[model samples]
Each structure stands twice: as structure tokens, then as C-alpha cells.
Target: MITLDHNTAQRIVDRAMQVIGHSVNVMTPDGVIIASGDPLRVGELHHGARHVALRGESLAVDASNAEQFTGVRHGVNVPITVGQHIVAVVGISGEPAKVLQFADLVKVTAELMLEQTALLELGQHRRRQTEDTLLALINGRAVPQSWLDRIGFDLAQPRLALIIEPAQLPGPDDFVILLMRQLELSDKSLLLAQVAPQRLLVLAPIKPASTTALRSMTEQALSLLQSSLSANVHMAVVIAAGQYIEGSLQGCYESALATMASGRRESPHSSVHCYSDDPVTILWESLRPSWQQQELLRPLQTLRAHPRHLLYVRTLQAFFDANGDVKQCAAVLHLHRNTVRYRLKGVEQLTGLSPFRLPELLHLYLALKSDDLSTKQ
Candidate 1:
């Protein structure tokens, strides 16, 4: 049952008195005054309010009739009904002829405030449940079967995991409301939760053989969200899609996070990243032994100590990206071909791995990725 608390009652009284320029009393259903502009009247039994609450109708107490009941006042007493239930009574103290005009306005205001509070509380309760359900799903833990049913979570449905990293956001509550509105997550196919202050996790349903359609849907939603948030919050929202949850759900979550980290390193300027975009990133993400990555990055250690380390590294990465095409690498970097060659030669000298040799260049390219993977970890 929805019942008015003391704080809410006092707020109603304060607001009503402010507007109507008269003392106000908020009373429980049983007639005891819970809040009053006149402090002494609080805790007193308001017979006029009791009449309205009991009858679920407005009552006007006049000076002539005030003596008919105990704790009487000449005022307009109206029932405050919330969701079809008369939860309380609001009484405005003045001559009945003068205060009766304000009765409807005050009653409506109180009911609206009560409804808003209920909706906020209901949304919070649902959000907590969603967070718990998503946590259990991603962790692959067994939740009560009833809990799963309550949330309408279909365990057998294939889902694609996505991790969203927003550059900044408003307060958590405000941002969540914004997300829900902009993302159009009312569809049961999409589930979202704020796992961190700046991070959100989404699990979207996917067809058995139509990952392309799923990606398109995700991209559209993210694009819409980015556009919607750009004016108020951020435009550079990076989202990364991990593996589909066919095997281990926990592994899917880990891969999605790892994919996000890789995206930041490999495609910082891009808004959306996917593990499908680079199979090598997935391989790097799955590499458990830190020593393997350390050993792979060993060749770059010498080159990293160089004063022009970043220049050499960029040159190597561009060279590989250009498929060893000197002109293409130079064009991409906006540097002269000879300068690109000089940087590559310096990298070869420092690392003892020639960028001109296919085998050594392959190792060097792997080392660059290793450097990225290790740094992100």
C-alpha cells in the first residue's frame, strides 16, 4: 500500500501553504495530523480531515460546524488519492468560503508528487534487479529460477556482449535515464546495466546465423546514442563487441572488456570496435602467460630506449600497415620516403630485426601488438 511518510507530508504542506497563503495540515488516513504549517497542530487529531479520509470526498468545515468535532478547524479538507487509493487528507486552514477554491489544486499537486515518488522508487527497484541479473548472467552463476523468470531472461537465447566506455557522464541516475531513453532499450532483446561509473554493459540478442544483422542493429543504436549524448555529455563514446555467448558467458564478458582495451590501443579514433575486426587481438586477449608477451616484446625493448622511440615505432607500424610499401607508408605518415626508410633502418639497427626481412618484420609486427596488449593489461 502507498502511504505518505512524514517528510513527504511536510513537503506537501509547505508547498501548499506557500501557494495558497494559508496554513496547511497533512493527516494520516486515520485522522492524526502528520504535518502542519502550525507546528502545534501536528500529532493532533484533525476531525475535518478524518471526515474526508473516511468518506473519500472533500469536506468543508465552517465556523458554525467547527464545534461539532474535536480538534476542529474552519478549513477545506480534501482527500489525496494516489493510484485509486485515498492515502491521506490535505486541509487548508482558513474560512471555508475562501480556502475551498484552492482545494482541488492542492489535492492534485499532492497526488502528482506522490505518483512521481512512486514511479522513481519503482524504477530504482527495477534497476537494481537488472544489475543483479546481468551480474549473475555475465558471471555464469546460478540465480533462482524464479529470478530468471521475473526478468524474462532466456538463457538459451544467444547474446552478443558489448562494453561501452563513455568519456564522461552526468550523475549516475541522470545518465541512466538518458541512456534508457536514447538507446530505446524498452525492447526485451536489449539489456543494459551500468557496471561502472563511466562504463555500461549491453547484452543484445542475436539470431542463430545472422551476426551481420545484429552488428547492424548495435551500430545503429550506438550511433543514435552518440548523437543524442553529444550535445549534453560526450561524442566520443567507444563501444566494443566481444564474442557471441555460445560457450562460456564469463569468457564472453572478459573478451568484450579485453576487446575494449584493444580498441583503445589499436583504433582509438573509431567509435565502435569488434573482436571480428581483428582476430589477432582476440588471440592476444586469450594469451594467459604474461611471460610470453614479455618475451615477444623483448625485441622492442632496445628500440624503446632510443630517444626517437615513438618515431621509430610509428614508422614500423605504418610500414607494416602499408604492407612494406615505402611510398605508401610515407604517404600515410606525410613524411618523405627516405625519412621513412631512415626511421625503419634505425629500428632495425636498435632491435637487430630488419624491417626489410619478411621473417624479422613479422616478429617486429607481433612485438608491436604485444607492446599494445601488455600496456593495456
Candidate 2:
């Protein structure tokens, strides 16, 4: 049982040493050397480990490229990975042929330890019902104080929890947990917990008044996650952006809900969409499909039959984007204001609604969204 403030990597390496009886070095999830038995090289780079990791290869290197190892006496670089992403590397200061088993052994052990530790930490972030329960668990008893000690969790920092679910899945619970903990352990977020089964909560420590930067960091976390997940699964990735609504976890649940809604509204081609960007449109898709085909795209199909109607819809969308300013719409369309008005008149004549009518506007918006559905993309 590795307790609080315990060095997880060091513990595994100790187990590795008992079998091999040789000096070994362990890197963090980010490629920095966290611990090394050799006193002379405690804080050196494991470039060889990094190289193997970057290449996703498990080979043996020797004195020829010793400089790459930063002058470590001798060692074999074994890449430590959770899935495909290289989380860390284990370097044993011995000959490959001699310590090949040891190096491989350490690699396996480190990988296993990393996987288990990640799951344990992931369980600490489950926040399904709302923010209060999640924060209480992440900051309180839902997590073991020992695990918190392992990662050195301090309440002073600002943390935001983001939830990511598969575009095509019901993937394993462990995978989600591992992913959150992997990102959290990367020194990126404060602490991550597995709340609400498929969900994860991340705690981000921010400056006293640095809400914007913290928010930016949370949004940026998506790319990192995208890189780490597998492409084999034919699914779209849904991310809930974390918001600090109240306490440290203020708006995380809200952001997650928005993100999930956007994901459901997406056409699988969309990689990311914020709820704030399209709340109503997103919600409309998830409101339990009305079996009525008319509810599907009647307005859009009607507009499609009218050749001029498609052109009109496009122009109107752009015009509305200009905030109903006719002069700006004319300039954008390379038309005189008179031509713009003529087209608007034509639209009113054909659609049975004035261009500015609220009902007509709502109908047009739905038509635009549903347009792509009938035609296979």
C-alpha cells in the first residue's frame, strides 16, 4: 500500500531492484527523471528513454550514443506506456543482453503500476449528480489521503475538471480513469477524479485572480486528450468544458452538460463544439427524436426544391450574421441594397413569411441545421 507522499515510481523500481539487484531510473509521465538510484545522475535527462518512447520502439542502446543518455554509465531504455501514448521510461544501468530481462521486467512493472495508480486516482474524480459532491470527494474523503499524498495535492491551487466520453463507445471504466489520472499526473491539472461512471473531474490550481488563464488551460486540455486516445474505435469524442461555478468546482458540471449536448448535436465530423457556442441547437437534437418525419426537415426540403430558395437561405444566414444591417449584408453579397431588398421580397413571396417574422426566422434556422441530414455526407 503506497501511502501519502510516497514515490510511486521509486516503489516499483525498488521491486525491480530486488529482482535485478542493479541501479535503475524512473521517469515521470512527462519524460523527466523522477528518481534514479545512482546518486551521480539523480537529476539528468533520460534522452534514450525519451527516444525509444517517441519512436514507440523497445531497443537496446550502448556507449556509441552515450551522450544521448547524458553520460549515464550504461543502460537500456525501456518505454513505459499506458496505452499507445508513452507515459514514461525506465532505464536500467546495465547491458541489454545482461539486463534485458530486467529492463523488460521494469518496463512491464512500471507500466502496470502506472495503470493501477491512474485508475485509483481516477476513481477520486467521480462527480455525476453535480459539482458539490464532486468537489467534496476530490477534496475530501471519497479519495484516500494516501493517494493525495502520493501526488502532493494541496488545496491552494485552482483546478477544473473536464469530462471526455467516446464518440462511438461504451468503453471500459478503467480507460477513462487512466486517461484522467494520466493527464492529471502529467503535472497539468491539480487532481482528477472519476465521478458519474464515464465522467472525470479535474482540479486546476490557479492564481488568486487568474480565472481566464485557468479556463484557457481547461479548454486546451482537449488536444492532449485527443492525442492520447485510440483511433481504432469508430466514435466521436465528446468533451465537457469545465467551468468554476461555485467553490473551486464552480461550473464544471454545467460545462460538462453543455459539452455533452454539443457532442450529441454534432455530425461526427465535428471534433469540438462548446455548449456556449450552440446551446439550443445542441439541445434540440437530444430532446428525444419526434418520430414524425415532418419534425425532421420539412422546412429544409421545401426550401431545397426552390432553386432560388437555397441561394436565399445562404444569403439570409450571412445577412443575419451581420446583425440585420442591410448595408453590411449588401456589401458582403456584392449587391446593391436595392438588390438585397429585391431578394428579401422574393423570399417573402415564396416562403409565405416576412424575412423578419419570428416564426419564419425560427423555421429558417431549423432548415439550415437539418439541411445536411437528408443528403449523406
Candidate 3:
């Protein structure tokens, strides 16, 4: 039997009173008046309700018999049953003959509401449990084997973890549902959970296919997510190398975080970035700021004060792109060969490093790449 607390019983009593246009009382199985239209009657014991709950049937009290029962009034009391057990008693306080017609209706409505509330509470409890389990799994906590078996999650296969940070936090259930719909993923294939208010972590196994085919599929999935979630959201994707196993999931998570941080610094405009596609940028981003500002970048610093700083930088980039071919550099820059030679001479004078020397060229190239990363930061 489900005991009726004061708050829930009061709601049932109030709602019954509204429908019947009469005073009502809600009692627990033990006959204590948890709720009643008459405030003074609350907490009082009613023998008529106790009899109705014990007998599992409706009990009608008339003026003649009302005095025989404790706190009894001329009314009709019906048992509120869920399944086969009587859990509560709902009564209409009025003449027995007059209120008897509405007694069954009020009892049925109250029971139905209670049943619905119970189901909703059960669902919420299960969702919270599932969320806790997933949080443990992602946080590197050792989950019990029984839990994994119950949930039917196998981590032996290669998996990719995508961490999504939304501009506005979404409800956990809504975010999973929308993501699945957008990605065309089934429950068996994708695992989605909200790890934080604004962050959602999704893990899915990489299907066995050719490298090219897998790459294409991943790109299409990312494109769909960007188009669907980009209304006010920025999304970043990080894919780990193949042959990933269960023990490596934490490493994959770390890689995803690094990728997200790097993407925010380098490719903020692009909604999607994969770790495997740009390892150089990711590695470069990991270097300390002090190490990034090496002596190789000193030559470029001198040009920063010049009015034609951008022009000189472009010329040097073009020279590297042309592989030291003066004709090719001129063609790429839309400049005469003489102009290209003159710019290279100016670069040598400013840096004391000739572009024709292999070591100098290599140093200049690395310095330019380092500078690009810094600028993006």
C-alpha cells in the first residue's frame, strides 16, 4: 500500500472538492486524515475511511450512523486502489445519498493521477542512475562488471569520442534525442550523455571500412552536425587513431580535449576539427609560449616595425612555396624576377640569414609557422 503524504493527499482532496462542489477529505490506509476541506479535521482519524480501506469497498455514512464512527460525517468514502491493493481513501462530505454519485468518479481520478506521478518518478530515477554510470565510465572510474553487462555496452571495439559544447545548455534527454536524429545513429551504435551543463560527450564505434570510406563517412556526419547545431553553437570533433581499445578511452578523451582547445585557438570559425587531420597544429599548440618565441622568430620581429611588414612576410612565404626558384617565386607573387630578387636581398639584410642557405631557409620556415600559430592564439 502506498501511503498518502500531506502534500499529495491535500492536492487530491482539493481537486476532488473542485469537481464535486463539496468538502472532501483524503485519508491514508491507516485512516488518518492527511487532507480535508475543513482545516480543523486534518490529522483526525476517520473510522469510516478505515473501514472502507480494510473492507476494500465503499462505505456510506448517514446521519443515523455518523455518530458511531470517530470524526465521521454524513458522507460517502471510497477506497483508492492501485492494481489490487487499497492505498488511500477519498471521501465527499455531504449527505450520503447526494454525494454517493460523485464518490466513485473522484476516487478514480485521484488514483489515476497518483499512478501517473509514480511512473514519472520511476522514469526520472532510472535516468539519473544511467547518467551516473556513464559519468563514472568517462571519468576513468572502474565500473562494476554487472553494470556493464546490464547496460550492454562493449568497449572492445575502436571508438571515437566527440565532445560537444553548446552555447546554451540543453536538457540531457533533448540533446541526446536531437543528436541521434541529426547523426542518424541508433541506440545500439551510439552512446550519448551530458557530462556537464554545457558539455555533451558522445562515443560511437568506428565501423570497419576502408580508410577513405571511413574518412568520407566521418566528414558527412560532422557536416550534418554543423548544419543542424550551428544556429548558435560551436562544435569541435576529435578522432583518435584506429585500433583503440577500452583501456585507451581515457587517452582518447584527453586527445579530444586537446583537439577542442587547439581548434578554438586555430580554427575558431570552422565548426568541426579532427585531431588526426592536423597533428602539426595540435603539437605546436602544446608547446610552451616561451619555447614558441625562439631566436628563429627574431628576424620576423624586426620586420614588424616596418610599414611593409605584411609585404615582406608574403614575399618570404612565396619564396618558400616556390622552393627557392626565383622565376617561380616571381610568378606566384605576380612580381618581376628583379623585384623578387630585391625583396630576398632585403630579407637577407634585415635577418643576416641568406634565403639561399638551406639551414637559414629551414629556420625561417619554422619561424614563420611558429608565428602563424602565435597569431592564431
lDDT against the true structure, per candidate, is 0.78, 0.61, 0.71
Clashes of 3: 0
Off by over 4 Å in 1: 39-51, 55-57, 64-68, 156-158, 168-189, 206-236, 247-249, 267-270, 286-289, 298-319, 322-365, 373-377
Poorest stretch of ten by lDDT in candidate 1: 167-176
Model 2 lDDT per residue over 1-377, tens place: 22212288778668888888988887653456777776566556666766776787765767676665665557677777775677777878777668777766787887788788877665453323224444565443365565445556654555555566655567675766566545644554434556567665555554443645544555555554545555652154556654444453434555556566555555455655555455455445434344532564654555567878767876777667776777899999888998888787777676565667777866666555555433432
Clashing pairs in 1: none
lDDT of 3 at 169: 35
TM-score of 3: 0.64
lDDT for model 2, please. Answer: 0.61
Which of the two, 1 or 3, has more lDDT? Answer: 1
lDDT of 3 by residue, 34-86 (tens): 88899999888989988998899898898788888976988899999876888
Candidates, ranked, lDDT: 1, 3, 2
Best by TM-score: 1
Q: lDDT for model 1, please.
A: 0.78
Write down the TM-score of every candidate.
0.73, 0.43, 0.64
The predicted structure with the larger TM-score, 1 or 2, is 1
- Judging by lDDT against the true structure, name the best candidate: 1
